[model samples]
Target: MNYLAHLFLAKDTPESLIGNLLGDFAKGSVKFLYTEEIRKGIELHRSVDTYTDSHPIFRASKRLIAQPRRKFSGILVDVFYDHFLARHWSEYSDVALEAFSSHVYKILVDNQAILPTSLLQIIPMMKAYDLLASYQEIGGIDNALRRIATRIRWQNNLADGIEDLIANYQQLEADFCAFFPELIDYAQTYCYQADRPLA
Candidate 1:
């Protein structure tokens, strides 16, 4: 899952949102890295990722990408799935996509003191671009892919990954629609467990 999916799956709270993104930025043992709730949120993010990667529907969606790009199919699929979620935001959340995105950005800003350095570095650009909301547009996905490609030191065709999404758009959207509900249920269960008050 990408930023949007991860954040959406997380409990709608400041710490949960930050930890959801931390799963990407924070590395190694987090035993003392964050508060209990935040740590659980990070764990929740990883759990969601594990389930997503192993899911048959998600695997089938990865197969939708054509060659050359097939090697990076997982990455392509993650971005495409986010696009579908953003495009169909109303199906999942009553909050407007832009409004939800602003809420997320505010949470990040308010908690910048506790965020990972990696996330801190990108927070400005993320909010400025309104990246989470921008995912609703293909151009935004294309720009995101290109930026990711630039980050890799070695040569790669990831920049051209947009073609895979365009060609397999229908199937990929179907895959997302089919798989997302399952993810939501799984994440909700995780949230329930995480949210239980201490006895």
Candidate 2:
């Protein structure tokens, strides 16, 4: 799961969204900084990643990536899954994708003061680029991968794996459809048990 899935799994609150997004940025002992609900959101993010990595359906999707790019397969699958989620937004949620994205951006903006320094810097670019909504396009995924590849330490061709995404599109979409519903259900249960109700 990536930003979209993490946010989607989170309880609909500023704290939850912030905490979920923070999962990638913040590490080690940061849970003490947040209220319990936000802390649980961070936990939820980790739980989602664990579930995603272990699930057999997701494992199948990784095999679709070419062997050369297999080292970056999980990264590619994460972004590709977000693309499918954005494309099929209507099936998963009642809210319009544009409206949902707006709400998410607003949460990030409204809670900017408490955000980690890394997220504070990245959130502005996220909102300006409207990266969440742009996941509907292959070009968006390609650009995102290129950006990510540049940031990686190794000189690699993670960006070129976009062709694998295109080649295995339908099979991957099927894999996503099978896996995502289970994730949503699991996340809901996890959050319900772990997070306190919003005021």
Candidate 3:
């Protein structure tokens, strides 16, 4: 699944209704994806008092969790999808919207237990049905999802706002800038767009 689908499924489907659906799907895809192990690692990392002598996955999870800025960036994406995308479903194509929605619902159903609480809360409040029912929409859902995901990616890059200074200080300024022009653009766009206080 694309990042948008992953985000929507991981964070936007209704928990009560999709619980069983997720379980069935998880039996197949979840194992293949090692999602359970990844989730366990993520959980272990979140608990600060836990020792890091467990395993490789646990250690990686701890590192990921230690980067709180990334976590916050994920939260911002969740907020945008829940508050904006879900409310404007009518503006999307029926086939694309349904396909995207079904994909998201299935994934949520499959990974219901491991999903973060920040994600679960967004699910029950989705306005997909209301949006879909009223309008004979066209291609907007795909566009919107893509746009939001791009915005999230950009925000994540900008979360490390000292990129130029770091590159220069590290004596790889030319090489770093040459290798990451898009990343630089993402950071710039994110800085321009973000309204909330950055961490």
Candidate 4:
């Protein structure tokens, strides 16, 4: 079984392992997101930095540090989401919160083996990007490109999570429990017989 699958099985059979597994997964997921986000942020920062530095409005305003501005903006947005919104907003915005959760769950399930649990942290941000992508007012190919970049960052984070941690353990347990009876039946039918080995 995959490490994550093993982790899931361990959760029920060896509860002591849960803490280590959760910790490992969390660290791994976080590292993955940090690496990917920083890389993308740098690239985007560079591009925007170059463009804005050359723009007449930016030049006139003396805002030549476009890269820092972009980076700061992203960091601020992330801080707001993580500190203020992540835990609290779901109470008021059920639809948006559910959509974000569902999207993260889908990604986690689809890439269970490769993604770390820590990376699931960015699911909300990715959902935000998804929402932006669907906007009709954004207009032009630039919006599409931005959306794609955001998504790629999201996917990269997902892959990193799978690599670092086993996620959706509860869901996996539920799935197994749901089908356990049938599995037991199959095991009994195929692997056991009435005239079995001696006691």
Name the best candidate (by lDDT): 1
lDDT of 3 by residue, 65-112 (tens): 224444443332222223233334444224455566566555554665
- Candidate 4 ranges with C-alpha deviation above 4 Å: 1-74, 81-95, 116-199
Candidate 1 lDDT score relative to the true structure: 0.90
Tell me the spans in candidate 3 whose CA falls farther than 4 Å from its real position. 1-95, 127-199
lDDT of 2 by residue, 1-199 (tens): 8889898888888888888988888787664688877877788898889999999999999999999999999999999999999999999889998888989999888888788887887787788888899899999899889878988988999989799989999999999999999999988887887344422
Worst 10 residues of 3 by lDDT: 43-52
The lDDT of each candidate is 0.90, 0.88, 0.34, 0.31
Q: What clash pairs does model 1 have?
A: none
Model 3, position 145, has a per-residue lDDT of 39
**TM-score of candidate 1 against the unseen true structure:** 0.95
* Full ranking by TM-score: 1, 2, 3, 4
Whole-structure CA lDDT of model 3: 0.34
Question: What clash count does candidate 4 reach?
Answer: 10
Candidates 3 and 4, the one with greater lDDT = 3
Please tell me which model should have the higher lDDT, number 2 or number 3. Answer: 2
Model 4 poorest 10 in a row by lDDT: 1-10
